[model samples]
Target: MKNWMKIAIGLWIAAVLAVGISMPIGYIPGLGAKARIIYFHVPMSWLAVLAFFMSMWYGIMYLRKKDMKHDIKSASAAELGFAFSILATLTGSIWARFSWGSFWNWDPRETSIFVLLLIYGAYFSLRSALEVEERRATLSAVYSIVAFVTVPFFVFIMPRMMTGLHPGEGSPAPILNANGKMYMEASMRYVFYASLIGFTFLYIWLFNLRSRIGLLSYNNHTEID
Candidate 1:
């Protein structure tokens, strides 16, 4: 990775931690201290979606160009997306344990994430089962495209439709006004926004790092063969 990228990553990491930990937040009726988890959880969830969309974009490019570079990019993005998704789920579960009185409630939001995880897992499994480079790249690219079709519905739509503890779903869902802004106090909103920006920078750095590794490994493998 470049020095600039490293510096950017460091700055964002600091900002995220600083805002998340030090920022004063209003106590929620129920969540209180535990509400702070949203700072981390929401950003990871956003990054997971963003990463997967990036993977899908690269996958489409691979199909159009038939370049291994695009395939590598797609795979790297998917890997990061999967990791973020897991983290988001874990953090959400922790928050739920405090907010909902249970660790695993099979809430719509939780179930949606579980299904998304399975879909992403299948992409990896399919890639591993293929030995031929061209075949693996082509098939995996196609699979990623298909899998992403469900992401929007699962991550955004289904949670709203089904009864769940998540925002926009059940009784305890976060309130949003006509402006579509969350009902959080001004201070919490500022920290949440900072965390979102910071996590976005972190995601870009991680994607670049993973893509570089993929490219180097591909180049080395080709040279040997």
Candidate 2:
């Protein structure tokens, strides 16, 4: 199979695993229904982190290479990151509503992720307002890199420092806490990891497609000139 086809198949398998195994695990006669959101919410948060760092990496590359393609890739990754972040927030909110008695809270993790969304929304606006390709690329690259500096602080440091309703905060152990003590059953872990891999592959596939379309459009415009 072609590379894209392989990726598509892998993603399909992952999606199937997420859907098929999530309920069984959640209904394990004791864990209760709140566990259902885990399949979607956890993967979304992981992908959001992956997407943002990928964007930052490409942004740095754009600066080093002065290649517009790198800028396009960086922007595409950022867009995807923004999307996953929103999904993570929404799903987290739903989970919180059921598990924490509120749909929204002023928790540090919540506030920080929301701030990230705003920062990236501003990024999109900044990119749109500029007409010159080189200027847009340069400005966006710089902004992406700079904004990424906040990601480590918000997603990592701040959450650790403050008390929050979120699970990972204030614990010596990682929030994910996937050690044997808190680990999902083997069968469930299979499905969960599959979902993670699937979403990650999907992100890459979409990024490549977007990058190709961007390159084609650029070429078409250049041809007309």
Candidate 3:
């Protein structure tokens, strides 16, 4: 990422935090004041899914081309995806504590996210167990692709299919609803979308920086051999 772009992202996120914290939003049904976390939680969840999808994409590229660069990129994406998933989980759990009066209730959405985390966690374990580079790359790629196949079902379908305290129950959440409609005020909606955009840009920057670091390590090992 360029210096200017990095600075812009920093400023943009600061602005998002400022507005999201201060802006007067209409009363949310179940969550009144705590609804502000939506700006961070939803976006982080989105980027987690996006990162996993990109991991699968690069994995496919590696399988097709047999290039180590794609493998590195795929691994980088998975690492970020895992990190973001943890963040999403933590944020949701905190929200649950206030909204549902407990840290965890095994709600459908919470269970699904937990399952998603286990699946990706195993992916990393699989990568570490293999000693051969080629085998590790191939297996990791295949695992990422197959694992992603379950992502939409778990992240999107399962939560809505079953009742849950984490929204998507008979009642709707603040912004994202399973009924295919968003119920946010105009100003809040704008901030929500802007936050999404800022986070997307931040993800791109982090991904690029991570990919470069991975490539550097890979190249140095190649040179040593």
User: Using TM-score as the measure, which candidate wins?
Assistant: 3
Task: Estimate, for each residue in 84-164, the C-alpha lDDT of model 2 and write its tens digit.
Answer: 999999989978887778999978878877887898798999999999998998888888788888777776677667777
Model 2, position 82, has a per-residue lDDT of: 91
Which parts of model 2 have CA positions greater than 4 angstroms off?
1-23, 26-31, 168-183
lDDT of 1 by residue, 1-225 (tens): 579878977887787777788766776665667778878888898888788889889999999999999999999998999999999999888778878878889987788778878978998999999999989999999998888887777666766666666643535355322245467788888778888887888888888889999999999989999
TM-score of each candidate?
Answer: 0.90, 0.84, 0.95
In model 2, pairs of residues that clash are none
Clashing pairs in 1: none
Model 2, total clashes:
0
Alpha-carbon runs more than 4 Å astray in model 1: 1-5, 167-179
lDDT of 3 by residue, 74-111 (tens): 99998998999899999999889888899999987778
Clashes of each: 0, 0, 0
The TM-score measured for candidate 1 stands at 0.90
